[model samples]
Target: MHDEPLPPGQDGQESPGADQARSGTSLTDDLVALLEDGKTYLEAEAAYQKSRAGFVADKGKWGIVHGLAAFALVHIALIGLVVGVVIALSRFLTIWGATAAVTGVLLLGGYLFARSAIRHFKEAGASFGDDSP
Candidate 1:
């Protein structure tokens, strides 16, 4: 058979392995480089996670502030509603009678809401297989 030169790589460039062999990098050198790269990657990942947690914490603080503000405003609005109901009822009944009626109704509604909350809490606990009181 006629002797022929080996064909060049697809891009007509030396492969990466050829370059590494020419550079005389030993297996130990390659392993050390891999370890360094892994350490750098892990450090970068930790920094990224810390920054993400800080961002979430900042946003969560604002969310809690806004939620509390909304809750306060709603409670204020409910107070106004209670006062308005008391005033309207006073036109047909004595002021004391109107106040008593409103108080009783509010207490009843609160009791019902508390009962529902207790039931839901028990259901949630049961779902987790927690039977303790």
Candidate 2:
């Protein structure tokens, strides 16, 4: 036979089945790749947000501690001032000498109360963190 019809491939006629198969494979691979990329992006973003939130929470904790320290320091300074004034005024006004001592005691008590309040705030803050709105 001089030229019997060559098969589809030999004659260069593209088969529809082959084209459909390749198209299906390509679509599947694209979907898989897109899913992986999305997963990676979400993981990285979650890590960054967590670390950043932790840092911000730590700053809040430090602020609580600083407030406690400041409260104590101010009371200490006030007590010292009152004591010094009382002693100095003793020469001029003997009747008011005890007033300074009472005031000093009250200020010291206030310092202790402030410390308690600060501790409460700190513990509460620690228990309730940035996770909440």
Candidate 3:
């Protein structure tokens, strides 16, 4: 019998991992890398969500800016509806400001929970393994 490294991508068996390995890729490493990427993404998403609360809560220049932006955008869309337009704008500004504030708070909360999200994803990654390999 002769034992030599298969030329580049010539796998003796048709196993999925074997095929990937023959192509100079490691399924195990790929899986780990994917999990790591997911963990990072989730962490970032969660962070964005959690911090949103604080950002919104701070009723400072930002709050007015959001309120004004919403006011302009929402009212501009209703320019044709003359009746109750003023009242609608008033109500919408209040509600939209509140909504933005709440969203900011939620973002902040998500940011805080990002760590847990990463940890959960990491644990999941650690769970995948084959003793035969």
Candidate 4:
């Protein structure tokens, strides 16, 4: 009978795991490598999800901070407008007339600002619409 070289991992030849014999790729080696790669992939996916969640939470906090800052700025501007109108009206009108005119102007300004703020809130998607969260 013609003596042929025995296939790897058979007869006297050591198995793939013996001496870390990785000369040729074997089924056992491939399976082990595949499992290791899968484990690595899952670990990476978990880390990505954790990082994404933190990023979204940070963005929400920043949005809230910015909204509060804008609110304060708008109030400051309104106070300035009130002072300017009062000063300007005192130049021509009597005290009572100026007061009445300023009251009317203040009321109008308040209404306008309220309307504008509501519109802005809606535009910024702060208003709950038909789309449910």
Full-model lDDT, candidate 4: 0.86
C-alpha-based local distance difference test score of model 1? 0.93
Candidate 2 off by > 4 Å: 1-28, 95-133
Using TM-score, give the best candidate's number.
1
Residues 1-133 of candidate 4: C-alpha lDDT, one tens digit per residue: 9899866666768864765555566779889999999999999999999999999999999999999999999999988897777788888987677778989977898999999998998888855567765
Who wins the lDDT comparison? 1
All candidates' TM-scores? 0.76, 0.46, 0.29, 0.49
Which residue pairs in candidate 2 have backbone atoms (N, alpha carbon, C) closer than 3 angstroms, thus clashing? none
Clashes of each: 0, 0, 20, 0
Between candidates 3 and 4, name the one with more favorable lDDT: 4
- lDDT string for model 3 (1-133, tens) is 9998655444544555666655686868889999999999999999998898677767677778998999998887755453344345556567566556555766788887998899999988888865576
Which stretches of candidate 4 lie above 4 Å from their native place? Answer: 1-32, 109-133
Ten-residue segment with the worst summed lDDT in candidate 4?
16-25
- Candidate 3 clashes: the total is 20
Task: For candidate 2, give the lDDT of residue 34.
Answer: 97
> Predictions ranked by lDDT, top down?
1, 4, 2, 3
